[model samples]
Target: MIVSEGQLIQSGDPLLKVDFKNVKDNVPSIVTPIVFTSLIGREVTLEKSGFQRAGSNNMISIKK
Candidate 1:
């Protein structure tokens, strides 16, 4: 995960940077939690560091 557990995140903070192609292919299933949370508020302390996939796609997960 870009931000570790208990790290405070502020608005405009980068959560994850993804390739447009990969996200375009899997938009229905992909979810960016940090980005969403930032949109609703100015900051948040992460409860989990979440997960990240290795290799080309590099998918990130917050809860699952």
Candidate 2:
């Protein structure tokens, strides 16, 4: 990894990279969601935080 004080970076600039083509016979990179989700379960529920209802007025922004 590269760290800079105030340097700017473009789109294709490389920070760090490694080659694993030969080692793929033993292990392979993960490229699927099904295999990944089966390893880890969901962590949260959307309703737990409760819904946001409009204020006094019908508009989303309330009047003072």
Candidate 3:
């Protein structure tokens, strides 16, 4: 994971890094949802600490 548990993450924070150069197109379709689900789960945890989705950039930010 790019960020550790309980780490303060801001908008555009790098969450994960995956190698797609050798990956097939079909693989991304299968993996995308799983990655998003994992991110949403993390967002749930952050929500408890006042984090929220920021606009349509698929980023999370601490609520003002």
Which numbered prediction scores highest in lDDT against the true structure?
1
Write down the TM-score for model 1. 0.34
Q: Give the per-residue lDDT digits (tens) of candidate 1, residues 1-64.
A: 5887778887557766678688879777665553444335344445445565543232433341
Taken over the whole model, the C-alpha lDDT of each candidate is 0.55, 0.39, 0.50
Clashes in each model (backbone N, CA, C under 3 Å)? 0, 0, 0
lDDT of 2 by residue, 1-64 (tens): 5636456775446644445465565567523221222224444323323343423222121122
Tens digits of per-residue lDDT for model 3, 2-39: 99877888766888877766566536442443232334
Q: What TM-score does each of the candidates earn?
A: 0.34, 0.26, 0.41
Displacement of residue 63 (Cα, Å) in model 3 is 9.2
Task: Using TM-score as the measure, name the better of candidate 2 and candidate 3.
Answer: 3
For model 2, the stretches where C-alpha displacement exceeds 4 angstroms are 2-7, 30-64
Ranking by TM-score: 3, 1, 2
